[model samples]
Target: MVAMAKKISKTVLSRTDHLLEVRDFVSEAARQFGFSEEDVANIVLAVDEACTNIIKHAYQYAPDKEINIAIVRNNGTFEVKIKDNGKNFNPDALKRPDLQRNLTHHRRGGLGVYLMRKLMDKVEYNFEAGHSNEVSLVKYLSKKQSLIKK
Candidate 1:
């Protein structure tokens, strides 16, 4: 038999104050799915990073727009989709920073994308009708691949 998946979605203003609310949502969702604290933290971190990017680069600090977050868990896997009305980004356009050289020189930027790619099993971006953009991330929970070990 297949397990039932849980789904949750919400929209919040593209403002800094609502970042905490997003974290709370991730925590609650993880708990409902029987995820450990560390697992929950990882999920929250990924979400935070994505949201931070959306706020900083997507909307460019415009308070008039909104961001939508949707989370779904099924068969020991979780998928998160974040949507915004800002400019679209090509995930493939990002280049992995030269950690050896950049780290020594203290170069900034480009780390968020790398971190997101590391934390999530998959990250994808799409532009809808040339007006809205969506970023989706997925993480799987398995005995061998789970972030939380028994």
Candidate 2:
């Protein structure tokens, strides 16, 4: 059976405190979209990392700006987009940390981006229209497992 499409979107202040809300929203969206707990957890982690990155690096902990989040589900796939109006960053410019040499003394900055890429099935970034930056993450749900059975 083909699954239905669903979407949820929200904008919140770019602050560390709102990170929890971001996580909760992702978990609830996953549940509403019939994602298993394990899947939900993975999605939440990826979303959290993205959100935290925005809070720490994008807005630089400045509560003045806002971060936008959009969650979309289609054909048993989930896509989460996090956007901010901060300085633009070229996603391609990010070099993967040398795991062998940087694993021990690696700073905190690059780990989140690395983890988000590793955990999510697809990750992309966009910088356009002056200063808008958007990061998108995608996850494909397993057909064999469903959080809600109708």
> For every model shown, what is its TM-score relative to the native structure?
0.83, 0.85
The candidate that achieves the highest TM-score relative to the unseen native structure: 2
Give the Cα error of residue 105 in candidate 2, in Å.
4.5
lDDT by residue (tens digit), candidate 1, 1-150? 545458889999988899999999877877667666776788888888888888888888898789999998877788899999997766677688888878799986677888888877888888888679888888777665444432
Candidate 1: what lDDT? 0.82
lDDT of 2 by residue, 23-58 (tens): 898898887777778878888998888878887777
Clashing pairs in 1: none
Query: Residue 90 in model 2: shift from native, Å?
Result: 2.4
Model 2, residue 103: what's the lDDT? 60
Clashes of each: 0, 0
Supply the TM-score for candidate 2.
0.85
Alpha carbon lDDT at 43, candidate 2: 85
